[model samples]
Target: MAKGQDLRMTQEAHVTQGPLTTEAGAPVADNQNSETAGVGGPVLVQDQHLLEKLAHFNRERIPERVVHARGAGAYGTFTVTADVTKYTRAAFLSEVGKQTETFLRFSTVAGNLGAADAVRDPRGFALKFYTEEGNYDLVGNNTPVFFIRDAIKFPDFIHTQKRDPYTGSTEADNVWDFWSLSPESTHQVTWLFGDRGIPASYRHMDGFGSHTYQWNNEAGEVFWVKYHFKTDQGIKCLTAEEAEVLAGKDPDSHQRDLREAIERGEFPSWTVGVQIMPAAEAANYRFNPFDLTKVWPHADYPVIEIGKLELNRNPENIFAEVEQSIFSPAHFVPGIGPSPDKMLQGRLFAYGDAHRYRVGINADHLPVNRPHATVAHTHGRDGHLYDGRHKGAKNYEPNSFGGPFQTGRPLWQGIPVTGVTGETVTPVHAEDNDFVQAGNLYRLMTEEEKERLVGNLAGAISQVSRDDIAERAINNFRQADADFGKRLEAAVQALRG
Candidate 1:
């Protein structure tokens, strides 16, 4: 008998209803198969439901990021553990026990969307904090420093890391050639080849606001700050061989690990710390504090513990929450602002521009990137695919109808500047030796770690075509550590033999 007739008859005996129906209240018929041309031919294009499904599927993917294309994300909360109101009047860090919802994305640089998780590359560590003031994005990286301080070399550096135009594959010569020419990359290259390069898992790594940023107070006091998110889970890494095996065994290992951990209630957490430098100290500092390629030594500026961030929730839908998410360093609240870091200043524009291209002009309207607090006024009119509810209110600012206006207070502190405006190479200080910290880091490693580091370096460097380029790259290692250079040279020679 038909199910509808059976249901009606059984209703006399108080039987329950069946499954839900379609939009027209008609019971769905044969959801497993689409209406096709006579059982075994082409599918009929006239089937509206089938056409709708296929059309949506075809447009499911958006443009991948130019860099940091592969990533994993989760939702979490940040709890203030210490009062930092003296430095900055940001509400989220002002009071102890105050909690704010946040979303974080950890990614690998120089990889496509389908790349391996264990590549020896810098990881993007970006956070979006939904505070009462607004959504403040701390777009950063796993390492505390970058390859170059200037923005002009960014495009060139990225090109070298990407696939070669002729071979359509990663060219080690291209990578080392760029590094050899640009000495500023020494510090970051040291970190990349070290044990921390191939982090065992995302939870076992730290995150850093690599560039110095500004923190302003209500009293107009400004402080330069560097953010550090120390992993409560502690640092862990895989050997080069182990990482290679895992890349083949599980390309999505990091993503799967995160999801499973959250499901099993093993939430990951990190302690938030900051190194603050006075606005007046930038001029007299031994090293240029604003340079993205350098670090302010702990002896000069120590870290102050401020809060804890705990990731307790996995996104229900990865595409909607993680893939569509966007973060920009320019997204700042009243108390926070950008520093004079050249590379950082470029990223402040580049990140937003990339997001607009990959996602949409209305990308901010997406649920993941949207501000939790109500947006009072924005002059941004319409663009491709806008989802915001724009009522009859006047769209333009400075209107008679009380549109959002500036508060008239200085958003950041004005530091003293006394240099003449001219086009010339700025003189680097005598103490700005990029090789020192790198050498120190190399010397600190254990014998086994050193061997693995040498092997890893040689494995990539041996693939380079030019012998002089290889020698120059080895010389960089020699500058860092003599034994490091000797071991890497032996490894490469053996490979050639």
Candidate 2:
């Protein structure tokens, strides 16, 4: 089924007038009672339907995602509102007013499957655009920056965010200890503890493609771009107190709010924009343009409006649509590719591998993950959930019987590389320290916002048992800004003392 194609064409009504049947389509005479020996002694093994039902029920669930476990998703459309051909030749973005079908999933980063929705955590903003060429997935977060720039440290970072091995609970010592050691975490930590940390609802927060991506035009000109999806519903946030109350009162607060709003026909939308930099300007820039921990300040490159995204429909089945759905940053259309951002590069491999291990290799055959506009003609076959859709077709290329061949044109322009790669720290640019941007963020906040940030930090830092760990964490902020550190240290001391 292609984008804009009728849903009725592919989907059939699940409820029918026929009697209840077994997996083999054989009608079952009695579904209510299981077969037993003489009606009471023992359940009989001869009841194939009973045995089958129990077995299937036992195996109903796939593994939950390691991250973004608790999430809500919706079906939507992304309409290109402005011409961006000068930047890229991606088919979906080739013309103004071109609309593409989309599925957006919002989630809390560090939460479990049963966690509360209103927690003070970064939100996942993963979007899948089913386009004419193929599916383009922009898996991102609400914040524009992350704790670390290198992917090598990602697992370690997430481990600290997750439960402690011994305590079986997240420890303040583990979290602050890692943050203090990794100075790169300062910027994201500041953002995490700020006013917007606890979004009131998924609909009211902004979304970002947090890594730098590559866009190329027809003439093979390359550009580095960052995506921004500003909420049309306006920015709304819950204070720490409000979030605690809401989380306890309604763990599904954000999820329910999104569903009810769409149900009421008040579709939440976002003004889509991008900040683009010429590939030539990447080097010699004030900061490392490819760093995942930094944002391309709006002062250097302003966001240009290009599209609109609105979520209008909730999924009929959460498990089949939301849980089974996968988004990989590696999913790219023509003219769009990844940058040298180490985190982005690592994710290119990790995301797909995780999905293959969790969902079967034929996971894409699931309707929600399938390509809409085009038929995928890959050689991959015969995995779990395999339907044999490509039966009798030659599975290999270079065959006389007309197998699918590769397109001669590359999806994105390639860059030149000269150095032998080993374990090497990324070459630093001017103004590339980890603390500057974080300190700058602190200074940019309003007085009230700064107070809240300090209070949040102090509350968490004071929980650490070791004074050395607390002081080390405070010193990072002090390096970022003296005022920030002073206020935070005073607050922590007052609480701890």
* Index of the highest-TM-score prediction: 2
Give each model's whole-structure lDDT. Answer: 0.80, 0.87
| Residue 289 of model 2, lDDT score | 86
Local accuracy of candidate 2 as per-residue lDDT tens digits, 1-497: 66546565445344354687888889887653444333111234466665565444323335987778899999999999999999899999999999999999999988889999999899999999999999999999999999987655666677788889789899999999999999999999999999989999999999999999999999999999999999999999999999999999999999999999999999999999999999999877999888888999999999999999999999999999999999999999999998877678667766776787778788888999999878788888897999999999988887888888888999888766544323345557888998999999999999999999999999999999999999999999999999999999999999999
Model 2: CA > 4 A from native? 1-62
TM-score per candidate, chains pooled: 0.85, 0.87
Number of the predicted model whose lDDT against the real structure is largest? 2
